[model samples]
Target: MPPGVPAPPRPPTLPATPVAADTRDTVAAIYRAHARELWRVLGRLGVPPAAVEDALHDLFIVVQRKLPGFEHRAALRTWLYAIAVRIARRYRERLRRDAHDPEQDVVSPARPPDRALLDAEAVRVLDELLSRLPEAKREVFVLHEVEELSAPQIATILGINLNTVYSRLREARKAFVREHSRHRFLGGDAP
Candidate 1:
């Protein structure tokens, strides 16, 4: 070793601080700001609407536990979205093993024709197309087109290459277009 001017002083270690309260506040703030988007992502990722609220709660618990170790290598929201995706995927797997479909429980009698129902119907149709897609293609399409994330950010989130993201997105777009054209109601005005 070269003669070093006396080694650099070690970083000062601060005594343990009350981080839990601060963490709670931070978590609360994150929930307040990003909960809706997280819910949307979870829904699109296939967490049944009925289970999304509970899934969101579970997601926050993981966030609280993992927040301290977050290194800021990615955008906070992106990291949260990644966590939400993982939670949703696991939830779907569990539900499959139990052979339960949450959508089967959603029954509404006494029809009220409203704008909300129309919108919901459209979303259902869209979900059917999305559900038909391979997970990789669906994720890339949603992250890019729906969530408006850049290609690079998506590559980071999915741990895939930039080229793969573009390729999947291309495939997803073509499939979505084909499906959309097949359903006249999807045109949004005339069936």
Candidate 2:
């Protein structure tokens, strides 16, 4: 306790707290669990295939930054899908601003040549049908049917009321079925 003695140098501050380590681990686990589904969901949500990978990366970046504050108001998958929807919307807006041709970004799924042709055609038809719906309806349809999320989950993810989800889903289904029937009547093979 000498008055002039310099205080002992503070113990080297640890670079990160255990809480930070826990956050990092949580982020990693979330990525491992949901990355692939989010990638697919992004593409289905209207992120051009060429940009889906970037969209997925951007999604995880947001997750990493915001996840510590996540309140668990919804299931993790629904929360992740909600994030993907926002990111995909941003990408779609950017594409619109850039006047990018999204069709050019469509890549056929890898398979035997014959099956690839069939699947490509099916995908094309489905995309066309999906594009015909209004955005709200399309979102409901894709979330409920394509992503296999329940109405309540879609409502949670889209921040809409559960009844609104049902309404949108009903309208979307009608629109989809109508369009699909037309395609079939036009001699297009049904997917």
- Name the top lDDT candidate: 2
| Tens digit per residue, CA lDDT, model 1, 60-176 | 888776665555454998788778878988888878887987556557663422224236866667667777777778888888887888998888888889999899999999987
What lDDT score goes with residue 18 in model 1?
A: 31
Best by TM-score: 1
Model 2, 87-136: lDDT tens digits are 98898788889886654655657432224323576665777777777878
Cα RMSD to the true fold for all candidates:
8.8, 9.7
Please give each candidate's TM-score. Answer: 0.77, 0.75
What would you estimate as the lDDT of candidate 1?
Answer: 0.73
How far residue 38's Cα lies from its native spot in candidate 2, in Å, is: 0.9
| Prediction 2 TM-score vs. true | 0.75
